[model samples]
Target: FSGTGTNMFKEEGAQQGFSSVTKSIGFSTDSITFGTIENGHLLLFETSSSRKLGEGRDCAYRCQDLESGRELALKMYKITNPDQRRAIFHDLYAQRSQVGKHERIVSYERVIESENTIFVLMELLNGKDLFDVICTEALTEEKARVLFRQLLEGVQHLHRKQVIHCDIKPENAMLLGSLEDGTANLKLIDFGCSCFKEFEADSRGCVVYDSYMPPEHVADSKLSPSVPTDMWRLGCTLYIMLVQRPPFHNDAQTQAGLAARQAGQLFRVPEYEALSPEARGLIEQLICGDPSKRPTCDEALNHPWLGLA
Candidate 1:
C-alpha cells in the first residue's frame, strides 16, 4: 500500500484469485448512493500525475458527483483496524451533527462509509488557509479588519446554533473568492473538533489547539470552554493577521511549556504598537485573563477595531 490508494479490487468478472492489473496513475471507483444523489460515483481526480490534496492523518482528494456533475472534495479515512473504524464513526457523527450548509462554514455534502474506508464529501474550495496567506502577503490593517469581521460573522453563526469550534484558529480559516480584490471572504473548516455546548456555560475543552487556548484553559482543565474560549482564539487569530505571528509567549520553544506559560503570562506585540489603538484594544479585551470578561461573538463584531461600531 503506497499510502494514497488505487483502491485495488477484484474486477466484476475476474477469477477472484490472481489479480494482475497495474493501473497506477488513476483508478475507477464504484458509485455510492448517498446524500441527494443516487448511484453517484465519486470519481478519483483525473490527473496527469498521482497526487493527494491534503496531508497528515486526514487525506483529501478531488472528486466529482456523477449525478449533478459537481466537483467536490473527498476527505478519506482508511479503516485500518476496528478501533480506527469506530473512531471514524464517531467523527462522522460529530461532523454531520455540528455542520451544515452555512455561508461562513464549509458546506457539508455527505458521508459514505464502505467496508474499508469512510469518505466525507464537501464543497471544493480554491484557496489557501488564513495563516499561510497572512505570513506570505503583507496584510494592511484595513484588510485585516475586513477578514476579521468575516471571521467574527462565522463565530456569530456558530454561537447562534450553540456550537463551539474547539479548534478555532487562522489555520482553519480557508480564504477564497475576492481575496485578490479589495474585499475578502473566508469559510471556517474542520468541524471534527466542534461541539454543542450550552450558551454562556462551561464545557470540557476536550478538543483544542493548545496555542490558541485562552489563559483560563490552562489554569483549570475543562472549566474554560464554550463561547468565551472561541472568542479568545479569535483574538489570537486576529493578532496573527495583523502582527504576522502568534500573540503572547509564542517563542517558548516547546508547545507544552508554551501552553503552561500562556496561562500565567501575557505579552503585547512590540510591533503592534504601530497598529490602530482600536485594534490593540479589542485584542486586549479578547485575551483578558478572565474568560468571563471576554466578549461574545456579537460583541466582538461590534468592536471598534472592525469599524462596525
Candidate 2:
C-alpha cells in the first residue's frame, strides 16, 4: 500500500453508524504502507511506491491481514492537478451513489484521500473480462444467450434507475465465474463515463465504444448516452459474442474508421442466421441502423428469442 491514510478508520466508523466520531490513524510523510493487522484484519496502509503490478498510472498493492489471513486489493490514484483530481473524485462518488446495491455493478468498499493521492477500494473481479472471453472462445448460441441475458439485465437495471452507462463494451463487462453454470455470470463494470441526465440534455455529447456506437451517434456528435445508445452497444456486444468480432471491423490505426463504419456499413446478422429464426429476428431488431426501430430493454426482455416467457 502506498496511499493509506487515517480515512479508512473514519470510514469504518461511519459505516458502523458512528457519523460524528471521526478519528485519524497516524500518517507518514512518505508513501503510505499496507500490511496485515495482528487481529486478522487486512490493514492497507500507504507506501511510497506502492507495489507496481503492471503499466499505467494506477498504483496497486496486495495486503494480507496477519491475524485473519485475509487479502485485499489496494489502489491509489496519484492526483497531480487539483481540477483533474476533483473530477475523478466526483466521478467516483457519483458512481458509488448511483449504484448503491446493484448486484451487477462493482461494489465500492472505501475511499482513502490524501494530499497527493486518492485510494479506492473495490471488489476485485476474479474472472476474465468479456473481451478476453470473446477473443479466446467462439461463443456458442447457448453461451451467447446466457451472457447477453445478463448484460441486458444490467443495462435494464441502469435504465430503470435513469443512469446511462456511456461506455458499454466487451472490456467493461466481466465474467463472474465459469460459463458452465448454465449462465455466464457477467457483471457490468467501469462507470467513469456514466451520467445521470435529464431528457432535454440527453443529446449533448457522444460517449460510447466507437465500434458499438449507432449511426445517430456517429452522425451527430451531440448525442449523449441514453437507452437507445446502450441498446446499440448491446447489439454490438451480442454480435461480437456470437460472431467473435464486431459487425464492422476497423483497424486500430484509423482515428475515425469505427465511426465511419458505424455510420455507413450494413451489418448482416451472420451469427443470428445460424441460430433459430426467433434469435435471428431479435438480432435483426437490435442491430437495426435506425435507432427508432431498435428494441428497448423491456421489449428485448420480452422478445421471444430471450425465452423470457
Candidate 3:
C-alpha cells in the first residue's frame, strides 16, 4: 500500500487513527521511508520538491507547505559526531530563545526532531537575493542608499535584541517584495553562526564564513563576536554592491595571511572613482581596517550616503 503514492497521507492515516490534521499537515510514519544521514533526504510534498540552496558545511531545502499553500525554507543538519551535535543543539536552542521579534530578521517557526534528523523551518523570502542582484547589475546610488538603510535598520533591530549576526554578506540579505505602496525592502536570513552577546566563548569550534570575517576576529579570540564585526561585514558588502568586488583579493590560504595583507592596507576604492564623494567617504570609514573606527549600525544609518533623500 505504500509505494511512493501522492495521496499516501489519506490511506495511511485512516489505518492508524491519526486525525485528518496530521494527514493534511504532513508527518512521517512507518510507511515513509527514511533516508540515511550521509546521503541526506530530499523533502517532497504534493506541490513542491526540495532544492539545494547554498554552499559549504550546511544543507538547506526549499519546501512548500501544502496545507498553508506557502513556501518555507528548511535547514537540516546531520551530525554523526555526538559531541559536535550536542554543541550545535545547545547553540540552536539558545538562539531559538534569544532571537526576538523583528521584521528584518527571518522568523523561525518550528523545530522538527526525528531519531536521525533535525530540521529548522524558516520563512521563505520571494525577491532575489541582494548578492545575485548586485552581481548582475551594479546598484545605482539611490538604490544602494535605500537598501543599505534597510540593512542597518535590520542590524540595529538585532543589536537591540543583543544578537550579533556574525555573518553579514550580500548572500544573507534577501530583497523581500516591494511594499504595497512600492518601496523595496530587504530581509536578513541565515543565523546559523549568529550569537548573543552573553553567549560569547572560544571561537575555535565553529566554521566561519571567510570573506566577511573582521580583522579582530582573525587576530584575537577574546574580542567576542560583536556588533562591530557585523559593521565590518556590512562595509564589505556595500563595497561589493557598488563596485562588484570585494576590497581585498589576496588569495591567501590562511586567516593570518589575509590579516597581514589587510594590515598593509592593500584594499582600495580605485574602481569607485566614478561614484559620488559621499559614497566613497562612507566606504572609507566603513572598511577602515581598524575595528574601533568602524561605524556602528546606528552611525552607518546616519551617514550621508545612506542618508540621501
Candidate 4:
C-alpha cells in the first residue's frame, strides 16, 4: 500500500505496484506489549525493539516464543473474518499446511486465530528482500544467479507440491544472512497470495502488479490462472533484479508488455544489451506469451544462463 511507483524508467527506486515487501530494516523503540500468559497465550515484545517490523495488509512484530525462548516474527492480520481472508488466499491455511516448510520457504511455527486477528509466528529473517537489495546494494549477474537459483528451487518445491505462488516477485523473496559480509541465501516469503491449484487460485488473491502478470491474465476468453503466471512473474523479477526495473511498467506499459511478450521483444531495454546472451535469452523465454513455451522451474534451473551444468 505504500508504493506509488511510476511507469517511467528514469526513477529506479520508485515503487509502481503493490508495496508487499518489508522495506524497514530498523525498528522504532516506541513500543507496546499486548498479551498474557494467564490467558494461556502470550506474545511479548522487548522495549529494546520496535513493535511493528513491516507494513502492508498485515504487520510484523518482533516477539519471543514463551515456551522455546527463541526470537521470532509475529505476522498479525487485523481482519478477523476467515472467509474474507480465505477469498484472498484460497484455503490459505490448508494450502500452506500442505507446503509446510522448506530451505527456501519461510518456516511457519504456529498459527493463532483470535476473535479479531490472525497471528502467524515465523522464523525471524535477518536480511533484506530482493527489492531492497536491488535498490541499495551493488548487484552482479553472479549474485543474481545465486539468489535466482534459490528462488527457482523454492518455486520448484511449491510446484512439485502442486502449489503456485501467484505473487512471485522481488518483494516476495528475501536474502538470508548479513548481506554486507557474506553470501546471502534466498528464502521465498509472503504466502498471502499463494494457492494450491492453478485453477483454484484467484487473481484477486494475488496483489499482483500489472506488469508482473502474464498475458493470459488479461485475455477475456476462458482461462483459469495457472502456475505459468508464476513463471511470467519470475521473468519479471529476474529482469528487475538485473536491470533495476521491471520489464513492464504498469497499466499502459503492461499492455505493451503483452505485445512484447507475444513478439519475444521483452529484452528491448538498453541495459539489456550489456548483459550476457544466456541471461537475456532465459529472460526472453520466461516472459514469452505462450505458457507452453515457458520453461518449468526444473528446465529453467538447467538453463545455460543459470549455469547449473
Candidate 5:
C-alpha cells in the first residue's frame, strides 16, 4: 500500500479515487454537497487565486448558495482519524445552539458532515479584521466607543445564552468598512472555541494566543471558558484597539515566558496610554486579577468609559 494516507484537498472538475487526492488547486464540486439543492449544485470558488482563506488547520471556501443566490463561506475541517473526527464533529454539533445568528456575531448557517470531514457554513464578510485595522495606530475615542458598544452587545447576547466565546481577540473581530469612515460594522467571528460556562468559572487550556488569555484561564486547568475569561480577553482586545498593542505585550525575547508572566500578573494599563481616565478605569475593571471583579456584559455596555452611562 502507498504510504500516503487519506487526506482531503481541493481540485477542479470531477474525479475519483486516490490519484485525485493530488488535486492541489480547487475542491471537487462533485463530492461536496450540503444537501440536495432544489435550484442547482452548490458552486464553489476560490476567495483568491490561492483558492483558500486564512491559514493554519482550518480551510475555508467561498461558495454561492444556488437557491438564495447569496455568497457564503464554507469552513472545512479535514480529520482523517475516526476517533478525532467524531469528537470534533460532535463538539461542533453540541455547540451548534451557541452559534445562533446575531447582528454583532457572524451568522452561522449550518454544519455539514460529509465522510470524514465537516463543513461550517457562515456568512461571508467583507473588509478587514480588527488586527489589520488596529495594527498601525490607535483608534479615536469615538470610533473605539462605537466598536466597543457593538462588540459588547454581541457578547452580551452570547453570555445571556450561556455561550462563552473562549477565544476572543482582535483577529476574531471583523470590520465592514475603513476605520476612518466611522460607519463600519463590527462582527465577531470564529465561534469554534465557544462553549457553555457560567460567570467566574474555570476552564481547560485551549488558549492559543496567551497574550489575551486571562489569569483565571491560565491558572485553572479543569475549568472551561467562563464569562470572566471572555471579558478579560475583550479587555485585551479593546486595549489593542486603543493603543495598537496588548496592555501586557512586551518586546521580550521569550514570548511563552512573557505570556505566562503576564497571565499571572495583575492587570495594569501600560504606559502607552491614550484613553481618558474613565476608559482606563473600565479596562482595569475588566481585566481585574479576580474574575468576580470584572463587569458583566450589560454593565460593560453602560460603563462610563464608553460615555454611554
Candidate 6:
C-alpha cells in the first residue's frame, strides 16, 4: 500500500502538522516503454525528450498516448493492492465533472490500471505554476487583477459544485502558456486534497500548507473545517501574487513556524499597507478570524475589489 489511499498529505508532501518534504522525483532522458496492447493502452515515454513534471505520491511524465497519438501528462502511481487501486479509480471517476468542467481546472481523461501500477491520463498544460511566477516574475496591478480574477472564478465553480479545494496554494495554481510571453491563462490543478461538502464532514486531519491555512485547521479543535478553509488559502494566494511573499511567515524553515501556525495568529507586515485599500480590505475579509465571517467564493466574486459578479 502507498499509505495515501485516504491521507492526502502522504502523497502530496509537506503537510501542515506533519514532516517536511525534501527529496524530489528526478527523471532522465531514457527511452522507456510502459505497456503493451494486450495490457490495454500503452504509455510510452521518450525520456530523452520527455520533461519531468513535479512529483507527489505519483510521478508525472510528459509522454505520448499510443492510442490517441496525442501529448498528455501521465500520472503514475505504484500501488501493490488491487483494492486500493480500485478505490483511487472510483474516487477520480466521481469527481471528473467537478474537477474537469471548467477550463480553469485541469481535465481528467481516463484511468488505466495494470498489474501493480495505476496511470491517470490528464490534460498537459503548457505553462508555469504560480509558485514559479511568485519567485521569478514581476507583476503590475492590472496583471495581478487578471490572474486573481481567474483564480476566483475557478473557486466559485468548485463551490457551486459543492466542492471545497482544501489545498489552494500557489503551487496548486498554474499559468497556462509561455512564461516569457506572459499571455497564459490561470488554471487550478491538484485535487488530491479536495473534498465534496458532504464528504468533508467525515474528513479529518489533513496536512496543509501552513501559511495559507486558517486558524481553525491548526488550532481550534471545535471549529469544523469547511468552505472557509478554502477562502483562507485563496487570500494567502492573492497576497503572494501581489507582494511575492506570504502575509504571515513564522520562521517557516523550522519548528517555530509550525508552532506559530498552530497558535492561529495571522498578521500582515508593513508590506500589506502599501497595497491598494480595496485589495487590503478583501484580504482582511478572506482571512477573517471567524470562519463564519469569511465570505464565500460567490460573495467574494461580487466583492467591490474584484467587481467580477
Cα TM-score per model = 0.76, 0.73, 0.74, 0.76, 0.75, 0.75
Give the poorly placed runs of model 3, Cα more than 4 Å off. 1-50, 54-56, 79-95, 98-100, 178-181, 199-209, 251-266
Q: Which ten residues in a row have the lowest lDDT in candidate 3?
A: 12-21
Q: Please report the TM-score between candidate 2 and the true structure.
A: 0.73
Assess each prediction's global lDDT (C-alpha) against the native: 0.65, 0.62, 0.63, 0.66, 0.63, 0.64
Clashes counted in candidate 2 amount to: 15
> What does candidate 5's lDDT look like per residue over 1-309, in tens digits?
112212232221111111112333565533333432224444332222244667655556676665567788767555566534433543353335544467888776655444445556678888788888888666877788888888898899888877777778888888897656657789988765666443224335344345666665455546566788788888878777787766764432255534544443433555445468887888778877678888999889878878743
Give candidate 4 regions above 4 Å deviation: 1-50, 79-84, 87-100, 178-182, 198-209, 250-257
Q: Residue-wise lDDT of candidate 6 within 1-309, one digit each (tens)?
A: 112122332232211111111223484444433433334533342222245677655447786755567887766555566445433533364345446778788877655444444556678887889888878876655677778888988888887777777789998888987534767689998766666554445545433645566766656544445788889888878888888787776653345654654443445666667778888888878866677788988888787777632
Error of 3 at 85 (Å): 3.0
Clashes of each: 0, 15, 0, 2, 9, 3
lDDT per residue for candidate 4 within 29-76, as digits (tens), equals 443232323345444333123556778655568876545677787765
**Leading candidate by lDDT:** 4
Winner on lDDT (4 vs 6)? 4
| Model 6 superposed RMSD (Cα) | 8.4
- CA displacement after TM-score superposition, residue 133 of candidate 4 (Å): 0.6
Across 1-309, the per-residue lDDT of candidate 3 in tens digits comes to 122212222221111111111232463422222211123433332212226566656646675554456777666544455544643453354345545257776776555444444445667667778988888787888878878888888889888877777778898888876533456878887776776544546533333548666776666655667677788788778888888887777543376556653563535666677889898888778776687888888888888887677
Q: What's model 1's TM-score?
A: 0.76
Tens-digit lDDT string for candidate 1 (1-309) = 112222232121101111112354456533333232234533332211133667755656777665567778766555576544433543454354555557778786655444454567778888888988888987888778888888888888887877778788988899997655854678898765666553223346344757676656565665645788788788888888888877765643355545644553445557688788898899878876677788998888877777743
Model 4's alpha-carbon lDDT is 0.66
